[model samples]
Target: MADNYKQYTSCCQAKDWVSLSAYLGFAAAGLAVVWIPIIALAGWCALFYLLVAAAAAGVAACRWWLEVRLVCLGGDRSAIGMLVSSEPPADKSWPGSVDSDFSMNLLPYPALPGIKQADLELTSPYGFLVAEQAGTKQHVGFFTGEKATEKNGVESAILHAEFEGAGVRDVLIAVTVALGLAIAALIACVAIPPPWGLIVAGILALLAFLAALFGTLFGSGDHGAPGDVKGAPTEVHDNDPVTGLGADLLYVYGTWVFDSLHTGWNEIHPIKKCTFVGKWEGAWPADIVDVQHRLDAGFADARDPATVSRQAEDRFTWAIHPLVDGCGEAVDVPAPAQADAGLH
Candidate 1:
């Protein structure tokens, strides 16, 4: 997240109270922890430095969520594209929160000029070994971007996953806090009425000073502040074979968003489940089939509607279905505008 925390809250749109509250919480906590030394060390003069330190802490917490690496989301859109290669694993540039991160290049349908199938970044948050069994290998399935739609103005297909804050932000936090604590500790040696008062201040200041020092070394946990980000490992196996193919395609049963604030790529973050629909041959028929619709007025689930491979795109191991194209036949495209007139 940027200094303003916009990267974290971009997907949230106007509903950013969660992030705001976190910022305030961290700042208040930092201030409260060292308030005694804050006054004992520099009288009222140190308030300015303390405020600055708190602000830095607040910004870090808002960005990293105490190193929790929670991904906020937004929007929902379906895309049909070809999975070029298969069985890719998480790269070196992955955040600690991501586990068994599987990604493959996708050439999104309604294919953009230069854009490939786009990156289908999947994670094994549950229990799905996608790198081995997502059927994610070389298939043209209907993928629903849980929180993103536009192929991107940049035309980049890599799924967005990095937080800008986790980078230089750590350096900033470490340097700021260390400097502030050091100054306060040094001042405590000279000021603070000597003897017992000075002793207490020295002890407190040393503990705080040491904390600031070790915190940078230990890492960011309390809101991902002043250190590198790391997380526990997780796995992926086929427990729910629905989300990996992409959720929010036919029916959006959850809140999903593009999460443009951090990384501006369309991603399914924690993939729910995925099934191997079929291999991607070539371009799908522009009019493949609307198996889920074209039956009554529209907007209803259908089963095994595939008279052709294109129509077969709606195969969901679960009831949640997919976006199909009209191929090899004229679409039974029903009129939705007259849907109010009752099914014929």
Candidate 2:
């Protein structure tokens, strides 16, 4: 975002586009615009001044356009809801079924270091309230009544949820457009009728050039971009539960990557979703005894695997079904332990 719109700042600092555009549009529409009169009063000597002023105006307008703030996403329970449940429920869990599933890999912030989880607010467009911690990978596990096994060891059941994108790569297309416009403006400025036209065209060209350059450079949706390089899968691990409290379940571990681009300040941008599969277990052993209490009654309808996949819904509820038959003697170790003894 910084690189993409950096040029606008120079233009804006030179002059106020808001005031100038208002004046130009007003002048174009016949207002008692002061700049035109000032330029006119000064005669041919002030033509250079007029071009500078017009350029300033263009910069200001572009600033206003590119300063779009990340949209506000809401849902008080979204933070908690995302933490505790994946699919919505039908009712609280009964003896026969589970109400909600658990998501353990919800990083409350972006992958950028030094960023606080408290500073990142969850938003509707963001899809989920997750922290994008640096060097973290999301992991998923199944609940098989006895033990949940990863490639390393037996563990509890947990699902890791990560957000890919909201169709933001469309911004790249926008950047390309802006670049094209800038090139055209540059060409027109060189070939245009008068000095004033050239300045206006030149100003437009500069803004377009900045938009294109930055839009493509930092517009990527990859969480680890512009920093340290890592080759492991992107999903984070949800800690395993106590030993022996096992149940039978299926786990799907994967990573979600976002391809994004920024166009203008107020313009709506789309995001693209790309997923990388890591590990998949069809019938593994695990436990949801402790987490089971948080499931909202009847939350399964929203998280039903069939429904979850059908709607292409990114944020929804899920169930944590604890198969009664899979249980073994409960291990008296810590409640929520991360990974096995040997994992680095």
Candidate 3:
């Protein structure tokens, strides 16, 4: 399983998210470098100062840009948890597409220290988890307050991260626009008068901010080479789907990411597969899985605690808690190879 996950992780790598601000920053810097000297030499130091300021602001706003994480965790790994939510695949955000992704979230067994019942790690897989899902009352997952019989939606990270929205090329265009705006603002400052120059800069900032905001909310997304799903992760519920209270799941195969484009927390973005392991049961998580001895055997080898702590401080916390069977300190992911050592 680990080997397969590693290969899968390598194939999908961490998709990049180039925010509007980042592209603008690069453009602003480039423009400043080219024209700053000319402006200063022509006795337009005020314009130079304004241009520098504009460029600096454009760069600063991009602090939260680039949504892809440094280390994409969960390569060739399997985790057992509660199926707190399920986002059935659909053509979400993007129209005329073959569904963005079939996504879901997992709440690891042996809950982590200081963990809440609502914490859900993201996962995206296709096909079906159960034949019974068709007849469930869950048209939508647990996040919907009125329907989720368990009230788990009160606090959960549903619909957080899933590859969808502006692809890499789209991002490139966004970046180009950002740079163009920075340059436009710089040029406007040079031509416009005193207070008006600042006003023009302000207007440009507003425009950029608007664009960034739109992109932040909707523009932040993913692209995996070609023939990959695009758009935001869609949630689904059916077959009297687990509501209010959710069912348990043995989430197998997946990867994690930390990025600003989406919540900026580490999480399982593209889950390879998920298994429905019956409903939530028992004091210790073993009580839940023991219901299916076969499912229990899968987690029998190791626990997710080994790398959960090191991966996310608050988010992936549920994995670290000791299992009812006394989970050992088994490392979930093996060390990276020499050449790709620090790629994550």
Best by lDDT: 3
Q: Rate the local accuracy (lDDT) of all candidates.
A: 0.35, 0.30, 0.40
| Clash tally, candidates in order | 33, 58, 27
Candidate 1 lDDT over 264-311, as tens digits, reads 234433322222323333344444224212321221232224423444
The top-ranked prediction according to TM-score is 3
TM-score: the better of candidates 2 and 3 = 3
- Candidate 1 TM-score versus the reference: 0.33
Per-residue lDDT value at 158 in model 2: 23
Candidate 3 per-residue C-alpha lDDT over 235-310 given as tens digits, one digit per residue, 9 for 90 to 100? 2232223333335444444454432333234344445434444555433354544544454354443235654445
In model 1, the number of clashes is 33
Off by over 4 Å in 3: 1-35, 41-64, 67-76, 85-105, 110-172, 181-244, 248-252, 257-266, 270-344
- True lDDT of residue 150, candidate 1: 30
TM-score of each: 0.33, 0.24, 0.37
Worst 10 residues of 2 by lDDT: 1-10
